[model samples]
Target: MSEPALTKRGRPGYDQRAILEVAVAAFNEFGYDATSMGVLATRLGLSKSAIYHHFSSKEELLEQALDEALDGLEGVLLEQSAQVGPVIDRLAAVLRGAVEVLTSRLPYVTLLLRVRGNTDVERAALARRRAFDRSVSALVVEARDEGSLRGDIDPRIVTRLLFGMVNSIVEWYRPEGPEDAGQLASDVLAVALDGLRVSTRSTGLDRLDHR
Candidate 1:
């Protein structure tokens, strides 16, 4: 395919990254099913041919966007801290890394969370998501076995509640807002890990019941 025309600044008018960014935004704003190449071209002020120059189809675009989100989450599992530390510490690293990914790629992650398996691409993304969840659940189970986490709660429930808190940030988090990614990750860990950690001393509830 012929290269896209250059702008006055001598940059390709719309590189694949730029097109993908616009496409992802549109996909997030309008459901992916509702978004078409014509809509993306109109948003880019270019011909449909220009979009095709970079991506083969809307499905290709969706696949790339979902990969952007899924790859980041999967990478967290491969991090040194996640792979090498104590199980509870590894779980904490995974949680903190996920918050980083979500905040850094808010649009992509938001689209990922909204996926419902309508297309083959969506189903593939869902499979990867399930795999990621299973990895997390395994870590939770390991931590509980190590006596770092409470034994009563099911590991699967812990995985869901932990990510539920992380995933919900998409609804309200803003890049321009006061809390940066670090603060947000810290706050999530503080609340989630503090409650989740096995207590060394009597709890407030234990004291109240005793009184």
Candidate 2:
């Protein structure tokens, strides 16, 4: 059979997914304003026209990438809130799910990281990001009210700090090839809930673990 029009190592026709994957990498490494469609083509070893066929422009690709990362949080927010057991448990579910999103959608999450509220697109992305943050903060408030979270820390400040740590993972954290994403997520949740701040009495998770 004849080889396709464009393929990896020049074997077959272009795969839109492969091309977009390259584009996402480029955008993540270089800011959206700095990355060009031509650079994306070079990275994938495909023609610029091939990328254009899949996405109209670099901004469109950015929009698409951010959508994938941000959308994952929506379902998490809905699912966690519906659990009636405890607020801290719900918040743990959120942070853990967020870490899963971090690993599963690395490229998209990286792109989301680069947005700085400079452009309209970036600003809109920031708004969406904050909305998800507010959702998580709401859970933190509930947790504090239920006596799970320490009353000394302001729920709003704690929520911001928690997400700040979670978001910073994109900067240097990479998923280990042999590590389980689920287990990693659980560990992160446990760390946040239990905290580096050790308690003399039974920990907040005592209730969760006994149930």
Provide the TM-score for each candidate, comma-separated: 0.88, 0.82
Q: Where does candidate 2 stray beyond 4 Å?
A: 1-11, 80-83, 177-179, 197-211
Alpha carbon lDDT at 52, candidate 2: 85
Q: What local distance difference test score does each model get? A: 0.92, 0.77
Winning candidate number (lDDT): 1
Worst 10 residues of 1 by lDDT: 201-210
Q: Pull out the clashing pairs in model 2.
A: 6-12, 6-13
> What tens-digit string does per-residue lDDT give for candidate 2 at 36-108?
8777777766688877888887778877778888998766777735366788888888888888888888878
Taking all chains together, the TM-score of candidate 2 against the true structure is 0.82
Query: In model 1, where do residues sit more than 4 Å from their true spots?
Result: 1-12, 196-211
